[model samples]
Target: MDTSEIIGQSIALENVFRILAKVAPTDTTVLVTGESGTGKELLVRALHKNSPRASKPFVPINCGAIPKELLESELFGHEKGAFTHAIRSRAGRFELADGGTVFLDEIGEMDFSLQVKILRFLQEKEFERIGGSRPHKVDVRVIAATNRDLEKEVDKGNFREDLYYRLNVIPIVLPPLRTRGDDVFLLADYFLKKFCDKCMIKNLKISSKARELMRTYSWPGNVRELENFMERMAILCENQEIMPEDLPDKILSAGGVEQDKMPVMPARFEWPRLRDMDDRKMNLKDFLDKIEEQLLLEALHSAGGIKNQAAEILGIKRTTLIEKLKKKQLG
Candidate 1:
């Protein structure tokens, strides 16, 4: 189905692709759900492209972006003089999308009253334009995407339950970027190359340390944020390689490398005193174990839970670190 456009090899994404492959050829209505910037619209486009109605027009409407008053006319064309601004009769999105596909983006934001009309269309494949005497039938596939939880909205009396059930015949949920593992680096590299080419500049490579910090930071804005950041770096980065210092402070802080919070060693090393152990009400063995555990945890965190990197930081073999972690029940 040429899902090459949808990037990511994570199991979470692969699962979504599998579902798409099975459902794209059919005329079943699809409901795509995900967090904002999770590529829900992109997925819907892919579905339309791979469907039987690929050659026809693919109409997209953002229900949330349009005003409630004018949205009806936008979806179903108003007749001439139907409203104050209706200069001439025009076809609506559904009519325009006849024999093709209709992508209703942010459908969860649709008005409850309008939702009744939508449900009617979904059931009967027909709708009437504003001030029109007759209903118009369309042969288009319906694909709706939303970041909002429609089921919750239905329970709250915001979304219609019948409409939710009608649209959710085939639900495709996209996973957030933070949970996609190495897909982050894959997408980062893709965006870096894309932006670098656009700017007519050499591609900037991300340093290993910078990549580690990126892996630790939760990307709240998902792919869109990463794409924007990569474009910014492409234009602003003077060096050919992106280092940890090139990343923003938020990422640095999330990775425990914030400048102001970094630890500094004393001028002279002082051995742990008896009073130090007594302060924590611990004996020598227990106090020393506590210190070891702290260092182990710190190493693990710094390495982003990579055993080999943590062992290198502690100057120990990976197997030895594993053994210690297992002994401490920290593995």
Candidate 2:
């Protein structure tokens, strides 16, 4: 039941872990609610792994994935000749998960009629197969997850109120990635290392500017999107370090990063020498000063005028940034 797989040190994520630690061993019906791609399935798996029935089958089925017409048979398997497709008897998720856990994913999308059946199982721990007369009992724990708002669905008559209560005995609400603060960077680095290892490439590191951009951008797709982006970088990155130019346009635009300001992506390594500086038609002091001023301005703009963050971006102490600002009459 190692939960190290669930990355994040944010207070929001830590609270989830605390609740999970308390409830994992219990048989209480739990409902995990979160936005899509927020790792609801992963949380459910952690719950099942830490539960008393860890050794037994941990069955999972996407209630929304199966067609509405066949969802019943998928949950509580059909008897032979139950329908045109039911030529042979088969066990359903509940039966297969006996003595373990049944993860009903996207349970909010379940048909109203099917929900009644699920509610019956939660209440009596018994269910009847499609076209079967006998009621079969199962010793299984139910854990349901959904990205939809079940409360609203219940009010709108889309989901049954009683079933919602039954499934929501213990609610675990997962926070979206945008609100997780520095956890974003932690996950970014983690995913970068992970994809690098998978691709058999030396691990790539995110540049300071790139890290700032990532921290600011709203990750609508959450960890799943970040993971995919990291894998893409691992496979496509031309350099060992990921810079602002290497990021996708979506990310740059989302972070309010100016694409023209980013360093150009070069196919090979190049260095700016004294001879290269000759084109600028300036002395070393003035040239260096201009470069320093531009960097300061970019850092301040990136940090949104937050002195501490701007200093960090510039790799200087806050006092140093302040002194420079005053010296340059730009404070």
Candidate 3:
């Protein structure tokens, strides 16, 4: 419900914010394009909220949600006798949003015929009901959005070329969530607190291992998927701190299980300065091997001698970890 709520500080989103700051004052036809769940509609609402038309109606029409036959009526009203059903006269999104903005979401899915009608309204600021004769001129600003590549769609002959040019006066592109660093944890914390409050669940912090697992997994569904994942964790996690065991099955085991094509030494030690022994140079591999052995000892001590849990923290396979333990003969 908050108008200015923006998420993530990725370079792409920062660029988007720069555009939003510049365009929020002017009445421009904006085309918000991005993959689904990237917050296109939120940006549209932000535009409306920031614009001079902030007090006026900001209507949002999903071109894909309404039926093809009804979509025309949804965008441009229908006269009582327009179709066989002969429904009563209606006010369309454009008409209802007169003196304001109308957001056409999923505009790429609009039928070719309706595209021309929309283009006409964009051009003349006027339209007629489906079966009415006189044109009703309305001062309406159009902001459109879609998940499809409209330019590519036009090139493929699936979308209209004229409408493409008409609605795309200003364009904003949003990047997916995976590319956004740190924002993941930021949003995760936000959603976790929000859902916990709403659902009356206790607050929780993600365990260190769980945090590592979350950071490594690829979120294909973007922000939406991450929110859902958080909600599930909030509902299921009973303790004050969420742990790797609390995460859903797929995520809990991700990243740590992948086979290591090259074994990198994992070590922790405090020893006499090797810098003083210049000519006594040992093979770097041997130093790394010794380092790995020392680190294993530290991990065992850190884990209270629990190898399985220690292996989980180190992000290595338990068997490989045990082999390392045996090679070094460290308990």
Candidate 4:
């Protein structure tokens, strides 16, 4: 539930954070546009978290997930016997989210008729439930997210232009993972540690070669795909390290780095000179910790997460290894 959980250190993400800081305090309707799985819902949640309505309810409904026939009643509620299934009167998302924030996800998939009601609500802050004559007013902040281009939908007569402009009062675009530079590795590490903690497993680390391959390969499914893949690895990988062989065929094929051609090498024994520290701009503790972490990860990988064997390989006692893991909070 952390507001800063939209993980990325890339400038594109930083720009989004900047915009979020400026706009989240108000009730202006925000339109979040991004490729599918770029974490649009996360962005909307962050917006609500920072908004004055943060203490209020946050209601989300997917326009694409729900059937068209039921979507109207789902959004605007219905009176008793409004439809065959409506045995009693019910409040809709808009009414339920009064004094709060309502997220309309995948708004592009919404039926045109429902779009009219949404548009009216945006204008009047009031709506009538199905089979109800009286108009119900609600003070709610609206946030909508879509992967499609609303301008194109508007031109095609699939979406109302006025609604598009109204909802797009403040626009936020999330960059896909492929374009996020080193953020791929950052997110990968974050997800790895997260899933490891969740499953109560020892720390899982990505091999440098695997990291390189991940960097080069385009993540078509973006952050969501990476998160799922890491969870799968946490449960499925036998070794503490994520190796090239462990990657999906799609990643291996896309990266085009054959494991047979590039086999793993033994750890080198290069002593880090003072010049090395100066070049890397790292202090002594950070430099040593980085080296120690890599060695520990390599040992764990070679021993397949066997603590005793890994400790023996590192020429350290089992207790020492456990202490280091604890210090690093990787346990």
Candidate 5:
């Protein structure tokens, strides 16, 4: 699988990748648990792509989305006369996924009776088509995912205990985005670039203050929410740079910064300190030079690359600006 699709460098995300690498090769039943919008389906697809069944069909069905009466026919194939709506013989997900995998999304929402059939299939690797006289055997892997906590469901008698154990032979719990530090900015930047490119707009940059607000805001909808917000910004935001005022009210409130009070532009200067030098592991000369280069770049950017204006912004002579640009090889 192209693991690049799963973006994030946080320790929480790295742990999930480690487990996925070890489990993808095996046919052991996997139960993925996570909140909605945490990219459970994406993770499962990656699993199948990395598995031996990569070339085979990867079938998926939402156990909760389908009617209970028809879910049985959906999972196990049905004969023409299996039910009133079974107008003709049809292959279910299990049959269609022969030699590949069947992803049972929202498995926790499955009815108890259907759970037993799933358990039987997991145990025997065979199942009878609805209203059929004999069993059909198929070599297929099963991967189930749910937003609910199966253990809690089992305790509450809403889910079958035996089926829970069977499907959870290998459990992969995805961490929520809120707990993944700094990953918010990483994803925000990626999504912004992607949406901007798709919309054929100039790439937008998030201000450092706006980034701080995003980092502190709890993204309840996870990566999906971030992607949507970026798309909206790409289409709706007029400014090239996303400042504090550009963010939505929820984000501003969460960051405890009022919209009316928020600055339209970032502060021009913040005095550097000894800690900055220590953080960069640079001595006095190199540290000062790095700071000068950053200011020069910011001035040039603000002036739209006009040398006279950039020199004025930095309060330096045009000749000095040219000399600095030449020395830094930034011209």
Candidate 6:
């Protein structure tokens, strides 16, 4: 549902857009490859919407999620008396999506035995229900997506080689967030606006320091992770800006793709000394903040704010420290 929702002006996204432009009007089976949360489904939806089947239903099924026993019935439909629970006849995904598209997510996790059934339908454009003896044909286009390495799966004999080759006819790879240039910040801002509007909340923008922290992180979870973090930060945000201190340590500590891109973690800051603060009444937030602030000041003072040197001395995040300064109004 989100087109052009992708961020990043990097060559990676440029290439992705080029591919999308070429594939939008075709009925070819497209295999989207990337790490989890890399927006594979989003791309697939974009492709379907831009194609001729825009008005048709988009049936999405996670091959790995459905129980193997029920998977066949779910994809190919079943007669009223097909199985134990088949009290009523039902149309499966393939049958219902006759003129539209079927997105098979996590295709790599599909059971090997069931893989054969899918391959057969792909080649013949027809399938039979679990209990029905009649073979039915459909005109649905298939779009398979996964974060798994299918080549390796084929090597390990976990996936059928022919099936793998078939689905990969038009492969589209999505780059990780770390390599998407400034796209991280862009996506964060975009999602922030979208979520706030959906929830009828005030628009909030992430601070410049927060943007820097986001840019520096590697984002192992990719776009999905970024969107998730932004939504949470917006809810917890004090005003109209997302501060670095609001993010979790794990996200802040992540490394970006390029050494020059910046760190994913927040900067360290020096806070009131433990003895100077009320310890007995300190909550988890204050305690962690105290530690972060203290480490940063010590590191900065020890290394005279030479980020590299200070990092080696205190093993704290320079990006994170910079973030703390912004949050504590120390910057």
- Give the range where candidate 4 is weakest over 10 consecutive residues by summed lDDT: 254-263
Please provide TM-scores, in order, for all candidate models, with all chains considered together.
Answer: 0.78, 0.77, 0.77, 0.76, 0.77, 0.76
lDDT tens digits, residue span 113-153, model 2: 88888888988999999989999999999999999999999
- Evaluated with lDDT, which candidate comes out highest? 1
Best by TM-score: 1
lDDT of each: 0.87, 0.85, 0.79, 0.86, 0.86, 0.81
Task: Put the candidates in lDDT order, highest first.
Answer: 1, 4, 5, 2, 6, 3
lDDT of 5 by residue, 147-257 (tens): 999999999999999999999999999998888999898999999999898889997998786787677667789889988998988888888788765777566445522
C-alpha lDDT (0 to 100) for residue 266 of candidate 6:
42
lDDT at residue 118 of model 6 (Cα atoms): 89
Our model 4 lands, by Cα RMSD against the true structure, at: 10.8
Candidate 3 has its poorest 10 consecutive residues by lDDT at 253-262
lDDT of 6: 0.81
Pick by lDDT: 3 or 4, better one: 4
Candidate 6, run of 10 with poorest lDDT: 254-263
Task: Report the lDDT of model 3 for residue 96.
Answer: 95
User: In angstroms, what RMSD does candidate 2 have relative to the true structure?
Assistant: 12.2
Residue 152 shift from truth in candidate 6, angstroms: 0.9
